[model samples]
Target: MATPRTRGAARAAAALAAGVLAVSLTACGGDDDGGDEDKSGGTGGTGTTVTLPRLDGESLEVAAVWTGTEQANFKKVLAEFEKRTGAKVTFVPAQDPIINFLGSKIAGGAPPDVAMLPQPGAIKQAVERNWAKPLGAGAQAELAKNYSPGWQDIGKVDGKQYGVYYKAANKSLIWYNTQVFENAGAAEPKTWDELLTTARTVYDSGVTPFSVGGADGWTLTDWFENVYLSQAGPEKYDQLAKHEIKWTDPSVKEALTTLAEIWGKKDYVAGGASGALQTEFPASVTQTFTGGDQPKAGMVYEGDFVQVNIGETKAKVGTDAKVFPFPAVGDAPPVVSGGDAAVILRDSEAAQALATFLASPDAARVQAKLGGYLSPNKSVPDSAYPNEVQREMAKALIDAGDDFRFDMSDQAPQAFGGTPGKGEWKALQDFLKNPEDVAGTQAKLEADAAAAYGN
Candidate 1:
């Protein structure tokens, strides 16, 4: 799950790992004068006793699938929120397999007040099963104006809003070692032909051109989606998501062909890199730059969040590691992958207040301070960004407008996120395992989609 960012500039690294780690309260700079009363009704004002209700009187239970470093960041945000609202947040961090745990809980009728889902499909499924509620009128209006149009659309299952996005990173970029490109006398590519030439040049320089990890069964799908964008453009991609078009379309076939061409290049990727199938997504990304000290691979195609995962690596941002938008293949429009919204579940006073605050430009600034994330609020100024890279990325996002889209896998039905699902990841894995059966694989996907839509 790589979040999308604006292109053309490097952003300051905000430690988002802790933000996604778990839900807990972190102390913030605020007075704890319980006896100090404010006289401005429920609102805090001088001489009035303003006491905000805590999130959970005894314990606020929150469930999420963000583990490892990401879970840690999530706890930090919760901790800060609890301090501000005097709530006790109990965090339940789970593995990537969140659906199973959540399914049982929803069935048991003991659902958490707030659940942080990585994919939009999970939220949709929850809504379908009545395990979740829509943000309703107020939340919808406020969030609609705060986030990007694409982010807002992700939370919509049918025509109702059910989620709000808090933290997001963009994925339509390629990360390369700046020094490697400079040493190889190669420039950042702006077109598919240029990219291929650059990759070939790098490969001929006695280094693995790309450090992609296809072993995980999903990493290779990144290439597929980007290729599709290059071939069919963003408009067709959207139709595909809504089941308006079949997966066996010529655009899809061309994308797959392009991927096969890249993968066909021997030594283009690290030897034994396919072993990454056994490794997790984060670990596989780390493997790309892990051996750069010995120059195993020079570049990797991933989202901006990879910067947060590759800790202790000598790859410094803008120096050792830099990102560029995936070059256009033919006449296709640019498409990037970003996270969905983080919907508010509880309509408590605190939840309402928090929601209102988050919808404000001020709150967007606060979020940037907490973790240099792209704010959906259009009102926030680019100068407010802490780092040059972030500022540039934010600018790109604003300019991208309707061209940006959510990750197809995340936008698809929940079943698509699973192993047996009909998604780009599963499709790529099947294609790679049996290249000769590409058409059969595409046919199976089309059949599944048709069945799901009852067409």
Candidate 2:
């Protein structure tokens, strides 16, 4: 799913109207000597420390939207930072439309030192408004050494770096119950035709083939995006993302019609369309993983975030629950990804130090070992991941380089791509309810998109 973020000056003005104030960190610089450390790849030991110059004990406020398992894992990373630099790191959760909170803070002149943003659009807005400080030379060098040029580009606004992409989630994956597939004698699909055939095989074995999460509209968007990228290719994907062509363009219809092939067969989806419409994304994963039911689905398609939901179920990843790249609909599988970007809001030696740490392999290793987090840093080894599948997924995404794209919805404004109850979500929900009405769905998509882009 594309993580949602807000934009526009009107939104900033509205946030300031609400009188929400952001509290800044009070810890000042100290003379403590954090051992002189290098900015290269290392495990930060007595001989090799992860330290930034002149930032030994300054307090820094960091912000992001991570919660639950993600939050817990990040704390481990922060703990490592505290050990390395002796700087106090406080995590402040950015509320919905972080633009609002950021706007209020900027207007009040109390922004955090570093804000970990989730949207490229927000990064662009922050850079344009001069609310973000570009990554320091140390941080940029780390990024240049550890991350691919594509990952680095997401942080750039007009070819100048304003942020560092730390964590990435590959969205082009379909998680399935190994037992269910094995019992049905259905191997993992390699192509769209193979996937349809596998769906039929699973359906024939007295089970629904897919746990469609129609209620959580972003899941639906991911479904459409994976197919769109594979069928229409990445160039058109880029064009569609920028709204250079209308959403009513034939590429969208081709994707939807392909979706209808499986969706029109109501029996293939657990609880049919109505149940799917009521099912949330987490529940969809649970339904697929928790089998031995009357009408349970076999697979749930989503990003690695679903792994957190899977932790709540009885299934184990790699052993019981397995995933494959969404079977290619065209020449090759689509490698869709999404992640958080760390941007400096307060220009300071301490803030720049923190940015340098976040951009390094040392910081990424802390979270990678805990699972559900994939770092774009190439220096982080594959063995650091929790499972081979996840390791391969992250490696494939990194290796995909120029071939990969951020979630399309994330690239668009929230109203057009990321909103829950309106825009693409609602329009796609309508299509799920009636898959055969491709033209009608296309019309709504164009109208909402046009309104969203003001085209």
Candidate 3:
């Protein structure tokens, strides 16, 4: 299960370390130099020099959906921000489709100063609603020094900067149980057909081939996005992401049909369709690695962050558990990615200062050092990653530069892509329950997308 690393554009990687991208957050106008430059904020792990403005009595609130270990690790980063600027920042736990949560908070006039938007659509929504404030010049300078053009573009809407993507995830890997594969004599698959063959082999060896987290609709979106991107190519993927093409396109049907080749086989999934619908994301991952050779499932597909859950099991990565790129459906494997962007919801001197801090390598490095985190900032040194796997994964993302695709569903409007129990989430959940209805599924998708996109 040793996945071959795709060599990124060397020229692109070189350019990544050279450019300065734009960010928008107003500096709080605090100009008290705290001793030496290094003490206040010299290199601070970020290769570029960043001098943060002091905010002695400034207090700000930041909101995101991160919980558990993810929340704890992020808190450490906030602590560093506090130490450097003397700003008291509180972490607010918001629910998924954070726009909905923020809508109520904004209406209540108690919105956090900043929010981490999980999708481009949500960021766009924030801007459309006039809830998001553009970043200031100081924040833009740090972004230019630390981020590449592609990363910077993700946060820009209507030709204006609105967010800084601090955390990134590679969503095209499939982690599997080494013992199960070894026992089944199954080789890692490189193409879609080969994947089916491998699944059959594993099933004949008395174990399920896949562990699907159907309960969490976002997982289903990831499944379709990877398949659609690889099968239909990036052009159509982008068209669908922007809703420029209907979801009922022949291309969509083709991808769904191909997906059904696996979903149609109940024997291939850990708990069958019904059971999978009841399985949450965490359990789907734990099931693959918990029982050794006789685990409930042989493989689980997710982003690089899957390593965090693997840490909870008796299995060890690189040995008991290993990964491969999602099998190719077209000429090459799909390189789809997702991330969280820091957006200013209520502009303030403290709010803007924090945005600038996040854009700096100094902030990214703190989270990168902790296991299960990846940063898109090129200035983050390879040594920041805790292991070789993470370093390779992070390099792949930075190296890909502008050639890779962002998550498909994340690009669509929130009503069609991100909401829980409604829109695309529920539509796909229904599809997962009855994958046989490709036409019906496509129709539902098209209808929902039309409403969301106002087509």
Candidate 4:
């Protein structure tokens, strides 16, 4: 769902903003030594290990939407698997809503051995469509050893596990151009009202306050999720995500009304709503950091992965660019996350072996060393991250523990959440274009959501 780049000034800034924060021994990172202590792929936290089956001359295909640095880094992980088990693993690039991609492949009877499913609803869909296989005992054990229960549960359908989430994103973050804040004499806002005040301050200083990546419907979903997760709280968030509650709920309206406070104001967003609707995710981030002392926008919101796009600019991460958690809209700030899970699409001994390796901290360690990545594996050491900022961000996510919620849009069916220009994505995009139509927006959202949810 994110584009990538080579690590440079923007990369450093993005790395900082991406929450390359620290993780402690008690958090996701444990006290294990950096080296592989055992060939068994042992779990540091569980003190148990599993011997992976040797795949000798076997070949496997692993698919995901990752490209650029992300794909490059994951190949490093796959390379390690090849070296360890003598199996050849090929990386297959898939499209967004990967379920559709896999569906075509499955229809052609040429499915990859394994696929990375980005949305929980997609994993469920794969299982329902019989395109995904339940993980073998070996892979399941690895997940139990390293992953949090919440992470583990996300890959399950009807109580049977299918995916091993190998990549995670902290979606509730706003990365800003620090020079903009300094010039405007603004501090990071701690509350929703304060955020608006800061925006006003920035605007008064002759700068647009925020960049909304409205071209990508998913970005709009992220904005709504953060507000709804904070304003309405988790229980209702879960209900809405599951379609147990309709989009027309008062909580939904309240969040929309609150979001309109900023989005409704043409001056607050870069290029205004019409312009924002034309800005893609990469441009939304680059515009904030590219203009030196004066940029088109002061801030852009997304996951820590925004750093990848940030790398496209000349800004130094901690210096020219920085991040603050999404400002609190209710009693507490929201921590909405997203991740990609490795699921077996064509089950076999080799595929199961690949799944097991992905669940191990061994695999997570490989990518963690590369910048702009986060892992939910509790056993990977803090030292695995290249720097302190990543460790700090990692620490924040791991620290959230039970308070954490996965991205709400990702929890819904792809037709509603993942699809571009449809369902919540399209409805929210329309809402962004016309923030004053709260009732109209709510009705449209309800209609799309009901159709998507089959309710």
Candidate number achieving the greatest lDDT relative to the actual structure: 3
Residue 321 Cα positional deviation in candidate 3, in Å, after optimal superposition: 1.3
Residue-level lDDT of model 3, residues 248-274, one tens digit each, is 899999998888888888788888888
lDDT of 2 by residue, 170-210 (tens): 77778777778888898877689999999998888878899
Ranking by TM-score: 3, 4, 2, 1
Error of 4 at 96 (Å): 2.0
Candidates arranged by lDDT, highest first: 3, 4, 2, 1
Cα-based RMSD of candidate 4: 7.6
All-Cα superposition RMSD per candidate? 9.0, 11.7, 8.4, 7.6
Candidate 4 TM-score, true structure as reference: 0.88
Count backbone clashes in candidate 4.
Answer: 14
User: Cα lDDT of model 2 overall?
Assistant: 0.75
Model 2 clashing residue pairs (backbone): none
Compared with the true structure, the alpha-carbon lDDT of candidate 3 equals 0.81
Question: How well is each residue in 140-173 modelled by candidate 4, as lDDT tens digits?
Answer: 9988888888889999999999999888998878
Clashes of each: 41, 0, 8, 14
Which pairs of residues collide in candidate 3?
Answer: 20-144, 21-144, 23-140, 24-135, 24-136, 25-135, 25-136, 28-349
Between candidates 1 and 3, name the one with more favorable TM-score: 3
Model 1 off-target regions past 4 Å? 1-58, 136-138, 148-150, 344-367, 370-372, 379-384, 417-424, 434-436, 451-454
